[model samples]
Target: MDEFERHGIAVVEGRDAAARALRSPELTSDPGLGSPSVLLRDGDGHARVRGVLREIIATLEPFPDAVRADVETVVDALGTSFDLVRDFARPVAGLVTAAVLGVPLDDVFLDHLEATTANLDVFGGTDRQGQASAFRLSVQLSRAPAEPGSGLAALRAAHAAGRLDDDELAINPVVLAHAAYENSLNFLASAGLSLASGVARTSARDLAAEICPARYVLRFGSEGPVAISLTDGLPFGLGRHACPGSGVALAEAEIALRALADVLSGGCRVEDVRWKTHPVFRGLASARVLVSV
Candidate 1:
């Protein structure tokens, strides 16, 4: 039993059942928190907000050569002995996210975005630090200058065109930034750890299924909060609230992991491996990869 189960939230597992539940009209993404994030609402408003985000994401559909090189650069910079989470995954994920926002994000901002994972609580905001970090990010992104045609810039344009309300404009950029950064960060580090484990190299989608970061997503039903397990291979999820950026995420992972394969090709030994205890978000806390090349 995990935190959600303890809080009387039902755990819907198995690929088939989870898929059905996810697409069911009986379940809703909104937890009644009145959060304006696209991930937290339903109906026309959800569609509208998602449409704006989808357009912004489509701009990077095939991903981009520049970002791909950035990913390779981050991985190639790895030294013989380095922490996979710190040295390999962090920079790679950070670079892609910064590209997504068209704004450079510092380590402190990324750290706060990672901490916002705790704010995904179904039990009505228990983590003070998470909430604080979220507030700080919201403030920062609201004031952050966006470049022309950037994701944030697109979002601002939507607001100007009356496609988004004030609350939606204020929060969704942070939501998008966090969404883009957190899962990729977890996925990259977990996949790096997997490669360092000497497993047979596999496709990014396959590895994404196996590693499954952002393990469970919350939905609401008559009974209350329900945690839908993604271990069933629905990593990007299903139905309306599905990760709109799945295409970008998969492409991003394929490039990063392919570049990572070369880095780990000579074989490696992993040391002091540690995993995060967060039930909903699965990832490595740290793992030292000692390259033998």
Candidate 2:
């Protein structure tokens, strides 16, 4: 059995297991947004979904200009490449979470999270004590606020009001970072692949609309499980604990896709596209492309 299954982490496969996981009370009994350890418990239940989304959206805006600009810059850099896993996804995610959580981010913070998240595959075993160090570094770096009057400050306030505990509060940034970055990365990668495959493009506003119609995007690639793996089992994760930020994640991805498509529409084409050898997640670590305006 896979290590995930051996550890009782629930290795869901097949479309049915995927579907059941989405609605499984075990997954949603607690929210996955605030911390990793807490995810072991039941999630906060599904009624909290809308509130979580709203909170994330509201938190992301009104970020310090520097942070927002950093996000755009990183995303723009990622656009030149055909792959989206680490190059595009992690950086974009860091920006999104920093923007949303009012966590001030710089190249340092971005680099740290990118490294930590990327090394997750290496963390489980005794082989890498560095993984543990990186994890601690993420926790520490994620604590700082992006701006004086950002939503994270308010979240802290609310937490002090007894609304959130120390574990939850500490975990908020980590979760936020993971949520915003990873999903954004995946969405961007998928969008890029879609453009590359000619299945979709950036310039066609109408086509973008059709490709990203929430439900449709959620199940868009059932036909090619190997290429895109839209089987509904673990693509977006499962149960209520699945990605609450999916809607916004989709929008971020769509925006990135549109940008890429727009650039390509202007005569740019990706070249030397590459892929990371990751199984749980699929993405291109890097690629060289020609961007002609």
Candidate 3:
């Protein structure tokens, strides 16, 4: 069953319909939460905040060599038996996220980032713990010092330059961090699982299209809230709010997946595979990959 039916949110399915809906000016990402996060708002504020985010994303557009080194090091250290999520995907995503924001993010931080996925979900607005996770991360980033020339620092500079107001400053750092972390975390783990399953080989781009981690995004239309499906070749979305950081994400994937391929070059067996139940983000909960000795 379509989960949106239970929530009373209409769904725009099919490629052409979804694409048209995404391009429709009548629909909006805003849910009247009056939230300051770029993902939840529309109009001028959305553009302003999104512009700042685009600039930050541009810094890592081509991605840095360090990203390749980071994923390589993590994959190289994998033991004969490892949980793909815990040992491989998590660290690769976490490390790249840290680089994206120029902050030190440990397991605890990554855990909270994962939890905050609910906060962004139109279906998950009622999740108290998810909201709490988002709040906690917002506070954490606000107080933590940022590395110069990093995303966090870039956001602060934008705030100082009057590009972002108080509310925008207060929440956007968390928004940016979550946006950077969650998709990568989900996509990498899901993609890693696909490769480990010995499925026919495909490029990271094709894998992403097939496994579109972000299944849907919310938009309020005259008919009320609706979920626009992304399964239709629009993995990164489209129109006004299309993902501004896709290039960086793909670069991250190419490096990480290449390293993963090398790690799995030899024969391997998989067992105890689990999958995340989250409606929006598609990923494995856990999977044990035992490389043949």
Candidate 4:
């Protein structure tokens, strides 16, 4: 609240007002970086890039058998005691992010992706480290060899077909990967905290609504900036800029959480729980869940 007050930004609370603010044509999601990333664009450019992304995401619509198996493998390998953020949620989220981009992401890539949260800061592109991380990821993706059916390949094809410009092609792939990873990473870790603490099992959709990891989304209007609270069952957002990868997020959570539940079914003790301080993305930084064998 002080942040908003300092910036002269309004706080759009409540489900109705937030919804209205999200849907209002008077507001725009772009934070003035002038980047080609879809998240920072509105109007036809956003739609065009978003359409390409939507098509790429469609490949995992039913949550592919391979992805499920990979998630299961990760879950099965979990030791009795592990940091849920590192051992469980991070790997699961990384795998899905890799699948989304059709490129295997390494620890470095995940580290940079995590750091890119600065790129999404509502204050705009003032975070130099965040900008550097995003730039590095863009460079890394540009040189990556993607198979024909991969998301990167699909993006290239779109560019070849003139659907996306050169700048869009270079950056949007990173944007796609970031979008797919960040919230899921946060949500999965937070949800694991709930499960480890003996909360009742809930569907992924319900859990997401409850956790609302991406706590607030910013929009600018003629008046000023407004931070809209998404905790009111608006986790995936509303209106034109709503998360394009929402379906994938839910599917990924369903599979990963189901596997996590099985691992914890024998009971567990959660310890050293910690939370990240970022006002926008809500998540745990560390939580050790010691499972009973």
Candidate 5:
């Protein structure tokens, strides 16, 4: 998460830090000067994002076909009214982090991770009481045993190797959950809604294939610029603390998109997918959409 704070300099990434720095007389108060400066201040978000991408590509390269097939089957079974944010999107995103960290995909584990981290749009931790409660529960859940060479095990091993300290070990999973869930859910919900409403399904499907799995997400300029141009923006986020798990999130979402496209190729079409109202993040608070495919 600190990695993101360092690297993902998008409006959201270093928001707190920038605000703090601005208070210093050394910095300019003009929002314009502060904007790009915060973005340019190198951070670890990019490196982490790269590492996560590498992990995802490795994990999925061996099982892409099977993963795609499974996603297709599951979506098909759910029978439309498919809430991408809930039914498919966040679960798969969470799974990617779990897979990398060597965590098992148990119901309890997933619930804990989701309850705590799912609502996080920013890769950094949340301040809400519910977020705090979830964080505590998730930490306990992550300490549970799992298969060898799994994501959690790997994280443990990394810590043992001194790659990560105890603090990093304890915090990384929460970081992972936050990284994986935020925009992945938003992308799925946003793209799915666009597809369902006949607003750009094909374009979204194509773009998902091309960009859903990001190489690196960059945040440029100030918040005003970002807010002004939502189109063509990378959902992986921007700046130094943008997202370390962008790759994992992208792979999972792309795979899901592919599955949905193939399954609903002829039979089903999406309709009426709603988005959340909060300005802090993007995702479907709830959506009612039919999946006839």
Candidate 6:
């Protein structure tokens, strides 16, 4: 809130107001984050880039059997005690992200992806490290090789077909990866905390609505910047820029969390629960869950 205040950005609260604000043509996503990225564009540009992304995301629509197996494998490997973020959420989310890009992402790639969260700060004027992380990931993805049916290859194909220009092709893959990873990562970890803390069984959709990991999204309009709350039943966002990967996120969470529930069916203990202070993206920094075998 102080960050927005410092930047003279107004906040729109409550479900109705935020929904109206998100749906308003007068309000638009901020462009300062980067050019040619779907999150930073509106109208034709946004639609074009977003369409490409939507198509890429559709590949995982039914939550591919391969992806489900991968998530289950990770969960099954969980020892008696583990950090949910690292051992569970990170790997599960990371595998899905890798599947999205059709490439293997190392810890370094995940580390940089995590760092890029700081770049999402609308008030990132003084955050050089965050800016550098974003830039590095962009550069890294630019040079990354893509397999035949991969997301990166799809973007390159779109560029080749002239649907996306050079700049859009270069940056949007990273945007797609970040979009696919960040929320799922945070949501999975937080949801795991809820489960470990004895929260009753709930659907993945309910868990998402409850956690609302990406707390707020910023938009610019005639009156200037307005921070819209996603916590108000708008977790996947509300309009043209709504998360295209929402289905994938929900499916991933459902599979992973279900497996986690089985792992903890005998009960568990949650320790050292710590939350990240990112204003826009809310998540746990770390939480250790010791399960009873």
Question: Each model's TM-score, in the order given?
Answer: 0.97, 0.66, 0.96, 0.97, 0.63, 0.97
lDDT of 4 by residue, 1-293 (tens): 78667768789999999899999999998767686988777889989999999999998898999999999999989989999899998999999999988999989999999998633565754678877898899999999998989999999999999999999998888888888888889999999888889899899999999999988888888877788999999998899988877888999999888989999999999999999987688999999989997
- The global C-alpha lDDT for each of the candidates, from Candidate 1 onward, is 0.87, 0.49, 0.85, 0.88, 0.49, 0.88
In candidate 3 the C-alpha lDDT for residue 274 amounts to 89
Q: What ranges in model 3 sit over 4 Å off?
A: 118-124
What does the lDDT read for residue 78 in candidate 1?
Answer: 87
The candidate that wins on lDDT is 4
Model 4 compared with the native: what TM-score? 0.97
Regions of candidate 1 where Cα sits further than 4 Å from its true position: none
Model 4, stretches more than 4 Å misplaced?
A: 122-124
Backbone clashes in model 3: 0
- For model 6, the stretches where C-alpha displacement exceeds 4 angstroms are 30-34
Which segments of model 2 are wrong by more than 4 Å? 1-11, 26-38, 43-54, 58-91, 117-149, 202-230
Candidate 2 C-alpha lDDT tens digits along 88-131: 55566656666666655566655555454432342144525435
Candidate 5 local lDDT, residue 73: 63
User: 94, model 5: CA deviation in Å?
Assistant: 4.0
For model 5, residues 71-102, the per-residue Cα lDDT tens digits are 56666665645666677666665555555555
lDDT of 6: 0.88
Model 4: lDDT to the true structure = 0.88
Flag regions of model 5 displaced more than 4 Å: 1-58, 61-66, 106-126, 202-232, 237-242, 266-273, 291-293
lDDT of 3 by residue, 1-293 (tens): 26778888888888899999999999988888888889988999899999999998898867788877878899999978899889988898888888878898988888888888634465555777777888898889999897889889899999899999888888888888888888888888889888888887788778888989999988997878888899988899999999898888888888888888888989799999889887777888999999988
- Superior candidate under TM-score, 3 versus 5: 3
